[model samples]
Target: MRAVIADGKGGPEVLKVVDLPVPKPGPGQLLIKVRAAGVNRADVMQRQGLYDPPDGNAVLGLEVSGEVAGHGPGVTAPPIGTKVVALVASGGYSEYVAAPAGQVAPAPEGVDLVDAGGIIEVAATVWSNVFMIGQLQKGQSFLLHGGASGIGTMALQLARVAGARIATTVGSDSKVKIARALGADLVINYREEAFEEVLADHGFVPDLILDVVGAAYLRRNVEILGVGGRLVVIGLQGGQLGEMPIGNLLYKQGSVHATSLRARTLEEKRSIVRATTDALWPLLASGTVRPVIAHRHRLAEVSEAHRAIEDPEHIGKELLVVH
Candidate 1:
């Protein structure tokens, strides 16, 4: 099997296509012939040596969609030949990835396998952080950072459909229009505008904030949170540390939560995936939740895929067709 392997840690230059032995499933795992793999910020981080994959796994894809080529002990739900999307601990950037059965779920019936692969991680993160941790409700307002991103676009639409009002912050002016197209009620251009001021200008004190840029927005986010609000941090694109006002957080009755799907325990990720498949699949099946795949790359052009994602001009999910 051909896989994009990383040499030590560096930039996209570190990624190289090399032939490797096809991985086999261990206990309670499934050997999937990967059709598509989702490239994420974590993959870039892993490539740059900021984050490392777990023991015995050097590959770095958090989500995949493919066919079950084989299975191991105790695996039963998704039988052979079942088209499915799955979350894996690592190694999804290869032609074959062995995933634990617990972390895999049947893909939406009508979704193309190539596109279906890109949906798992985005949907998993959204379901867990927004609806579960944030406790977003109808008529309540939620603020999302990076509103035009693959996860951002999906999050905005899901939040609106789930009955919550949505607002988003973007780095570009064009993305504001794109954000609105996807259902965000207010789009603040953070390049030339202060998100805190813009939201307050509109009388929007968000009850929940789904933030991707963590440390950079910390103080402002804390300032914009209404009483008893929850701020969930999904990414640390903006530096990872900052001096925050603990007194204000206590006085304002707010909580800060940081979550990552990749490093979660197996059972935890499984439950998240199962819930996503159960609640989110029907929406995709009925066209209520549509995937926003922006670009697809051949298995060998993984370097280019990384470049495009980092370029900021490429919006939506970037997919690698491995099989």
Candidate 2:
């Protein structure tokens, strides 16, 4: 199998395509003939040596869409030949990827495997941190940091379907329109204005925050975090270091919950998978929520694809065709 293997510590150049042995599934696992995979920020971070893969593993992708080719011993749930998409904690950047059965979900009735590439990880991440951890309730307002990002777009749609009022901070007017089209009630251009001011103008001091910008949002995020608000920090696109006001958090009763997807346990991931399939799948199948793919590239040109994502101008999802 050809896989994107990263050298221990280096830049994107180290994520070269190389011939490697196809990995097999162990007990309670299943093997997928990869159709396509979502290229994530974490994958880029891994390539740049900021994030490390699971011990002894060097392949980079964490989510993929494909068909179930075979099941490991004792596995019975998604039978062979089932068109599915899977969330992996590691090693999804290849022709075949293996994951525990619980992480695999049948692709929503009519969703193509290629398009399914963008769902698994983002859905789980949003559901776990934003919905569950932050306890984002229906009728409350939630704000996302990157309105046009794959994660941000998905979070917006999901939160909308969950009956929450949605707002997102985007880069351009174009994205402001896109975010509105995706059901966001408000879109703030963080480049030209203060996001906290925009939120205040709209009377939207958020009840919950699903942030992609980490330390960069640290101060202003607290300003917008309503009394009793829950802040779920999921990404560090902004610089990772900063000092936040403890006094504000204490006075406002704001709670912070930060998480990293790749470092979680398989059981914890499976829990997220089950929750998404149960609560979110119907929305997906009904087209109430959709995976927004900005561009798709062949597996061989992954380096070029990575470049596009890091360019500061790319929008939506960056996908890699693996089959």
Question: Which has the greatest TM-score?
Answer: 1
Tens-place lDDT per residue, model 1, 219-253, is 88887889999999989899999667888889999
lDDT of candidate model 2 versus the reference:
0.85
Clashing pairs for predicted structure model 1, backbone only = none
What C-alpha lDDT values do all the predictions have? 0.87, 0.85
Reference-based TM-score of each model: 0.97, 0.96
Best by lDDT: 1
Instruction: Assess candidate 2 and give its TM-score to the true structure.
Output: 0.96
Model 2 is weakest, by summed lDDT over 10 consecutive residues, at: 6-15
lDDT of 2 by residue, 195-246 (tens): 8888888888889998888998898888779999988888888989967988
Tell me the spans in candidate 1 whose CA falls farther than 4 Å from its real position. Answer: none
Residue pairs with colliding backbones in model 2 are none
lDDT for 180 in candidate 2 is 93
